[model samples]
Target: MNSGAPSSGLDTEGLYRVSGNKADQENIQLLFDKDHTVDFRSLGISVHSVTGALKSFFTALPEPLIPYEQQKSLADAVGIENEKDMITALQDVVKKLPQIHYDVFKFIITHLHRVYQHNQNNKMTSENLSICFWPTLMKPNFTDMASITATLVSRTPIQPFILHCPTIFRSRLEPNSFLQPAEGKLIDIEAEPGNL
Candidate 1:
């Protein structure tokens, strides 16, 4: 998807913000289900369709990329005072993800970081991408009504999480990876009342 996005979707105004044609997304999903090797550009698949399928794949997972028990840990790690400690804490939590989850998380975050790097064209900074992704990445463990309400009211601050990702996953990132250093000044979610 990242490979195709540069030529086809990265320059689009809203890469992941807009929905793709349902038929295109379904077709892509069907190909994926059949385990066929897909070349989105060759198939003339819309970038939005590819993105939609990517997100749908995550949402359909039996367990979210961030496991149920660890969601709060990730959120708490983001709330730590010191930036280095925060990165360490996040890394610790991420290290515990099942191997497949870790790999997929790394790939998805790297892809999103690439999309963010092209924000001038796509208009999707880490924050906007987080808004589109957090629910699927960090799902609630409970199914009961009370827990659901609590989960809704106190969701993870995925924007800050994404912003700190470069440091958090430094060891796992590739040398030429788009997961370059995050913004020079990390947003203090608590300090920034406007962000809250």
Candidate 2:
């Protein structure tokens, strides 16, 4: 009674872990693309669907420290005393999320700051920035949701941004086998009869 393709012997629970391994190899390709101070300490982790494609990925930085040139502007916007306090505030939020993988959490916070800066400079846009984190769990145990909520709410006045968690699912449906005929799609009925 098996009407579908044979199972590939892959465990669904282990799909994410395996996909993450492959993502690591792919990330190495980024190094060849451009030259920058590659922070090898920061690793990328991604989940894959049962179909063997990437679902989501995460990247992390050491910590959130505003550069000296931009510290004054960011401080003024957040109404903080100094850049050190700003860094501490960001750290506090990250500290609350002990259960979240370090890479993912850092990626989220880092992009939040980036968006905040972009808005301040009047460069906000709908296009997503190259962010490095993906939220996977529905209810993260390490960090309180209220903290994330508060941070997002506070930043709303600055610019639009998205926080996503990775998830992978299996689909049994297959794509269409053949392209549809396109002969009759165009409507040239209005053309002059002389053209014939």
Best by TM-score: 1
For all predicted structures, in order, the TM-scores are 0.77, 0.23
Where does candidate 1 stray beyond 4 Å?
Answer: 1-4, 141-156, 173-196
lDDT per residue, candidate 2, 1-196, as tens digits? Answer: 1101012211123322334345554554465236444432233222232112222212222322222233223224334446456444444433444343433433333333333334433233322221111222122122544334434434331111132111100011123201111364311211112210
Residue 104 local lDDT, model 2: 44
C-alpha lDDT score of every prediction, in listed order? 0.67, 0.29
TM-score of 1: 0.77
- Poorly placed runs, candidate 2 (over 4 Å): 1-81, 99-101, 108-153, 157-196
lDDT of 2: 0.29
Error of 2 at 28 (Å): 22
Candidate 2 has its poorest 10 consecutive residues by lDDT at: 164-173
As a whole number from 0 to 100, the lDDT of residue 112 in candidate 1 is 70
TM-score of model number 2? 0.23
